[model samples]
Target: MAGGSFALPKPRPSGPPYFSRNQVANVLHQVAVLLELQGANVFRVRSYQNASRLLGSLSEDLGELVASGEIFNMKGIGKGLGSALTQAITEGRWPDDWIDLHTNTPPGLIEMLGIPGLGPKRIKLMADELGVDSVASLKEAALNNQIAPMKGFGAKSQQRMLDGIELLSRFRARRRLDIGLRYGEAFQRKIAAIDGVHRATLAGSARRRKDTIGDLDVVVAVDEADHETVANAILNLSGIADVKGAGDSKISLILDTTIFDESFTVGHIDPNVLDAIGGDDYEQLEAGGTIDAQVRLVPPHVEPFTLAYFTGSKEHNIAVRQRAIDRGLRLNEFGLIPETKAGDLKGMEAAVHSLGAADEAAIYAHLGLAYVPPELREDMGEVLAAETGSLPSLIETSHIKGSLHNHTTLSDGEASLELMADTARKMGWNWLGIADHSPTLKIANGASAEDLLEQGRTIQQYNAEWAEQGVDFRLFHGVESDILEGGKLDHPDDVLAELDYVVASVHAMTKWRGRDEHDNTEELLKVIDHPATTVLGHPTGRILQGREGYEVDLYAVLEHMAEHNEEGRLKAIELNASPYRLDLDWRLCKHAKGLGVPVAINPDAHSIRGLSDIAYGVMTARKGWIEPNDTLNALSGADLAKRLVR
Candidate 1:
């Protein structure tokens, strides 16, 4: 599992595709480790360690910035570490000393560090003192209760380790839903191209729009005579690693992603860094995840019913079948038939029945239920909602008219104001809100007073041009002001009031490591109380796999915001669209909706590519039961402009 051809691209330090922030940060971190291993000066080690963290947290590309000769002006990264990064750029590897020190470390010991929630120091303790060198060994120790006897890792830590290992089994089997969607879409086209194929589409959790996906289920309908030909052709496709099953109706293969899977770009400091960067998680999952496509030869009159039946969530199928029984009809993948005992219909993926054709609505009509969208097919009261007439009219991608709480080169963003606006206009947006960092987050290049004023003037000129061109597109000047340790905005009241919008966010204020919980929630409440505060950006400030959200009474903060919505104070809660920081998380967004607060699905985009993350945010929003009216950016340009000033 450890050995493979490491054809890692030689990172170009100055450009678009440098090694990830995490990879570079990990190098710095490893330098500190190597220095420690060599008994180097404490200050020297601390400097590297600090620089590692600084680069890890950076929103801007440290490589590009450093390559641009800006690292000298930056705080935290001193000359020594900066030189190391510079050397790494040209050498195409970490310093030789780091490699030598890293090689001397015990084999399989790094795997122990892969355990989430456990740092290297602790892993070393286990490796040196307890002889736990691998995950398997660690899990065995935990299961045998041997790990419970350790000094720091007691019974609780032992149990947690065991649970994490169990979770790892599941996590390693599934793909992030976004990745699955890509694979699913690519395969759909390939399957549809099988001659005589009528239709091909994804099923299972991918169809249900789950955040993570297990093995994919694809369903195809074709002519009865073409089933063999279609199945044979798919079995012979290039990149089909192995054929697991080849039946008249089903063709199962392990499609190697090597054909279509791009090198998934990754950032460092992620909890899943080893799994993603090492390509272990990708290999482990795809090696087991099978693509099963069911080709049912059905009449044109019966394809829709077949697709609906095959594209089922098991719970949904059970509910629908129960409904069919109530109506004296039987629902199965085969089609609708007369009511029959379960024993009579066993072992049949296909069956012939009465009173059913292709369309789902017609079948649902027979069962006295409404057609449920595939994404809502989970048994989350959708069936009952269908029975009644109250299904939520979910928000669509088209409903979003603008983006808010965005960043540009004025702050840490890689793109400029002109570029951000161009990207927004291309996406059919009527307006955009640029809430660059206020002067507190030195790490994110928070704008100074002069910088904000200059950006404001630039936005003014852009607006004038927009008016001149008779274009609806407009830009709202805003600031993502930091909330200081207490409750004050990073920028002055006079400064914040000058902007069209304000986004007060907790940067250093939240004691994410658990120093203060009650106070942190109170700090957020006070920020929300500010009359100019527009949206609470990433309310929890969590990186999903990397870091837990800062401790705060989220429900209490949301309730407080709801009570203070009179003058549109804390007007909207942001569903920040970064893959790592999907905060306020969907669960909390649902609560916000219940509290009558609208959610804004902001990409929190620092670059143009970041704008595409809106889809992920929208998916999270849909999961939160947010509708167009429940979202703030659904407002048009003029309306949003008016609201921001109000």
Candidate 2:
């Protein structure tokens, strides 16, 4: 059972409310829709849509006003809509037509809208053209040539579509940090081999630790004379499916191969053959010629830089450019240039044109701003930090002392507690917490009251034995309790009190959509404030691509945690490190840290294979700018136990 902390506000008065004018309008609109769908007058349907739009724009909650029995006093609510509103508010059911329309819409079609290039219209067309209604079907159709013959889709477009689908399929839904790192290393090695190249680094999403990538971007510096050689060298690299375009300064490849895909012929190519191919020959080979390749050099100063800049998230780079513009400067991937240079900035966005000095710091100086690291270039708080020279020394992997949330055979986990403890010791951890699931989660073999007690005794025995043997590591008794409907924990207060530490979570209440049903965020806050609850586990309840977690206002939850901490709440937020569910998204870590909320970077490991995921968690923590002191696992075992007790 997943257990986590949450606090609930005092319950408001229950029962149905009188419909307000706005509520009446909304209900009337729904009635109109139902009426039209059932072959009612067209005018009535139009009225419903219009009224719905109007009601949605209203400032106050119509249901609240209706509950107060004050909605009848508002204008524009005739008897028809008023009746519908009252019924809906009291019973929580939509009118018939609205329900039917929702039912008729294919759920698969709705999911297709989220893919990058596919829109609603395109999805409908694909459904009509190739009978593809789901992502899986659409991908199969694209790969199998069902999409190429469609109007407006040529070979190139089909390839792009297929590439997009394949990219999405190959990587785990959220993309892993390691994929980006691996590609970065590959790019670095390729660029470093160029005779005149001084430096080559990857920036953008990869630097930000995004798990998947659309394309790889590499920035390189070379002597003006060697620019063409570097560009040619890059274009000549093996495994490039297509050269999107090549210019003197930069080269772009639509990667036809991946580190994981071995079926591609290049994977088996001899190193000697790879070395022997000239840039032109390589380009020809990449263009689908014979193995012998040739390449050419072009001027490198401008194009490579532009390509690098363009490859990043345009929104992120645009914000940076705007900052430079504000200071009478222009910034691009190459460097910062003066705004009055009397040249078009369009093509040269990535080229470092006019900065007086080399490196990012010098470019920032030119713009009268301090340098920002590539990793923190997302424009969140990095810009301000640069100006203040108060950038955080974000926690890195080495700062972590141990993992606080792990599983063993006592639950559904693959490894036993003793094995996990031994592994933790080998990893040089000063402490480890074994937090198996509580009993309510039968699928995971969650522990019963007796099981938990036995586990605790075993942990205590192991701790003593290890201490006697000078093993130096300590194991703590912990359990992950499930949060049930109505925001209640699986275990009672007495059972919870027996554990050395409790990590509360929501494993079952994922389907509760109505905020009124359970204030999930508030409930989590309450659990955090619970005397026995020490950590909130996987706060979002997301499983990466598998499922989006229960709806909770993350910012609100973080703020509440921060506020409670000031009141001496000992609750800590979890950064679960199950690669697929790196909950507590790194993007929000900095904000949590800013509030002085301690974050527990837990592996959430279920087995020995899962244990290695701690590295990913540590990377995520670093990305969030978490400091060692701000992380719960950074504490020594005794210290961690004491902290939990508090």
Candidate 3:
């Protein structure tokens, strides 16, 4: 559709692209669920579930696979499911004969499965007994005592159903930060390219780089007269699935996205695309997720005003407004102006005399404050810091010297060690730390001691060869040693001591599973006290939307490390750069820095391409006011070695 386009002759698609790999998988999954609800054959239902997962884990594009006639030979694809995937991709639905089956159940009934104590049998009972078809109806029945009188339904079960609804409601409200940005930026760019648009910038928590975002706010500037043109331009964008409203000044819409064209190209392979297909931390950009989007257009003079106003933590804006009031001025989305009584002024936009409003820095200057970065706009003493000229120079991506928590093909990573090292070298770094997982975490195919020693020899040879070539890049070997439930390390101290650094982490049984938060806290304390443990990997063991962090007193853990840092034990906490798991979240980074604890903005990358996530980590660290001095990886290899305990 751009420079050139060629149609693939075989596997002719009957329609334009509609379903992404995720959508195809979801359709199969939904079919399986609906069949089970209706009591279909167990084996038949299980087959659909298996195919859904197989598709979810695929690297190849489903449409292209069908187009290439490769679906028939693919593993885990039986004839029934193969036909269904291709049908869903091209036709956007299952076969005509199956339409009734797909639509037989009310869509909301599937959501009931998410409630912890509810299953198909319970749901079927509820449907039959209460005539419930949606969460709303189910809630009504529970509240009305309709289900409590039925068999196997009592006060506790009704209470659980109510609790599950509350939890799902919260999760439904906002998206994790990276997820929103991944989808928002694409439309932001597309809208800014429209004819009447002069500029486009994402505001709200996205611009401020918060850990999670409620919605994306985009503000643009255009000629005063081009407002409608820009608004309609936003309405027509491909992924703008639903328009909530539209106006001259602003428009609200729902954005549903799959992997954008910029992120995925079927049948096209590149050497640099680690995690190119499916690996940890990699998914379709948006993965066909949905988020709320707001687009607004303003006059050039009011561009900075609206941007700052919209890109605010409510409290941050309140602080700025109060400061303006004290100085005989007022601020709003329109612009900054002389103080006006309600009766004397039409609005903030109608001011006759203006202080400057063309840029955020100018607005801050007029208010007698330094330009605050979006990351620091949390109103967390930033206003006073701005007043006293004591604001910090937040760390940037360039400040990171090299990453310390990286993975390779040796353990659940997409790229091989050679590939990962080559990528690190290309980034102009002096060294790269490779910390594969321990053997006990067999799900990642963790490395044994023999494998570690063999990898060490391979690294030494590569270093020797690269040295002769004058590349000057060195490799450091280590393991992401698992911290078991009891706080003991998966590897022996001897094995840990053989490496450059041991990144101790809790990968499984992290939740407050029948144990006190104090138990988890003490567990981490013991692990951190291990002489061989150098950094804590994802101190929280959180996977963003998928899993909450384990229960533990993180503050106590950070305090413990602060006291131990001088001893060269547990030198840093990982700012895991994986979009899904930016653990040791930026909010806590500042506290760690204050405690004299260092951090490593490690990509926790599974492949070379995944290394780019370091940029996100750097931004997150900035949000916590972390500086170069607060990061261990900001050091040269030699200095880093000196900083570590022998």
Candidate 4:
């Protein structure tokens, strides 16, 4: 009452304005709380909290205000808060207060919050009470009999914590594409065995072509009446850890535990248990035992495949769907269906097809479209080409005539060259190339020029012996040579010129600091254009987590190779099937195919077990829409030799 002239603080902006500002301010306040909880400076913490509240009350987006230079007019927004908001919007970074708060928080704790039972309070309690700060420390303490003895932790709680840690570890180190497919296939098999489940297929990320998946999603189609029973049957499966959520038609559960647990436990569970838990859990739970569940179920007639079909990339599906629509027809997860006389088919494949379409081809023909290959389903203009009857013939496993790019004990490989050759022959390959590393890579026992010549003589003698025995397979001398800095091949040009084939690779240059500046793409293009270089080995020198390799512009390299046909424009890229580094990433394979560049789907096999990796490569190639004609290995040994020679 000093002057009795208090302005009542501008009456704090009425209605939604105050509410909206308060909400935003509340979020910012939460950030302050998090920072304070992490022990940030009290004064700085208050500033963020105050700013958050002030910004939330504003009617317009903070970014828009900042852009229009109207932020200064907003109450409580001074130069400091304004600058912070601008930084957050433009750089996708937190304010200085946030950065300071985060700096004090233990690393990986943010990710640890994702675990089912852990929360901020509990995490803080663990940190304060038991000196547990990291996932590794928590795991160590749990295993060492420290956590269960803590104030609120019980034996069951400790076990759950251990399970959570194990799950997190497995989830962190998951293998990509194949893991999803295998889990989906296994789940499909289980669902198929159930009596009332007329059809079952995997959907979601597995369908979308994501390399690694967090969960497996299977959608089953049954008779409308049988949905509840089928759902119950799935929930009752042996290895189910918990029924996360369920409805009359849909049920979500976590499957078996991690591989570490699987190997130790009886009746080892499927490795994809984490993926079975999904975002639909809460929805399914809320739906409960109502007809609303029926909304999620695919109809019996085409549900199984349709569920699988729809679970993939929506972008990919849209492309496929648009293709169907353009042809005066409709397509869905079920199958291609004719358009209704009334214009659209209500997304029902059976009803639309029953109106008198003969087959898949016939359905496409009716739409004035040519048959589209399943492998080339990734929209990428394939549908347009198919309509014009210009779709490329993608490579198939059968198109591969010979196995090349194998290693032996002469390097870091497990088997002898002869053993690898015998296995290649047994696999029905017409030829096999031994492309062990060169001398500089000490870890692999890479051969010197003299050693390579001796190895060549041994291979020649082995081929001579096999030829005398009338064996159909021929052995070609090759080397997986390291591409050194300055675009130097591992061996001198003369030695490389002597080999039947040269798989030029960036092994040591994987960690070269000047990757972008050194022009790895141009360097690679130069190698591919080299007269002696036959195949570009693992175009991306990646090793999973170990390194990402040079950011060589693959599209540019592919385009360059496409343009330089006279100097052997038909450069072959390796589909290195080392599970960790599925190099020449499948995404790039499509670009290569589009440019008419050749690919070599090599297992890059180091042993008999490694040879099986070809299946993985085949699937990867299929995903990229690579056809047999685009791969050099699809050629017969004589034809392949002829091409390599030139």
Better of 1 and 3 by lDDT: 3
Alpha carbon deviation, residue 32, candidate 2 (Å): 29
Clash pairs for candidate 1: 22-268
For residue 264, model 2's alpha carbon misses the true position, in angstroms, by: 13
Clashes of each: 1, 45, 1, 21
- Candidate no. 2 TM-score: 0.66
Candidate 2 global lDDT: 0.63
Q: Regarding TM-score, does 2 or 3 come out ahead?
A: 3
- Candidate with maximal TM-score: 3
- Measured against the true structure, the TM-scores of the candidates, in listed sequence, are 0.67, 0.66, 0.71, 0.66
Clashes of 4: 21
Model 4 Cα lDDT, one tens digit per residue, 433-516: 889988877766888999888889888898788779987778889998877766667899888877888888776653543445
Tens digits of per-residue lDDT for model 2, 294-317: 122323443343433644455456
Q: Name the lDDT of candidate 3.
A: 0.75
Q: What stretches of model 4 exceed 4 Å from their correct place?
A: 1-170, 204-210, 224-226, 257-297, 320-377, 465-470
Question: Following a full C-alpha superposition, what root-mean-square deviation does model 1 have from the true structure?
Answer: 17.8
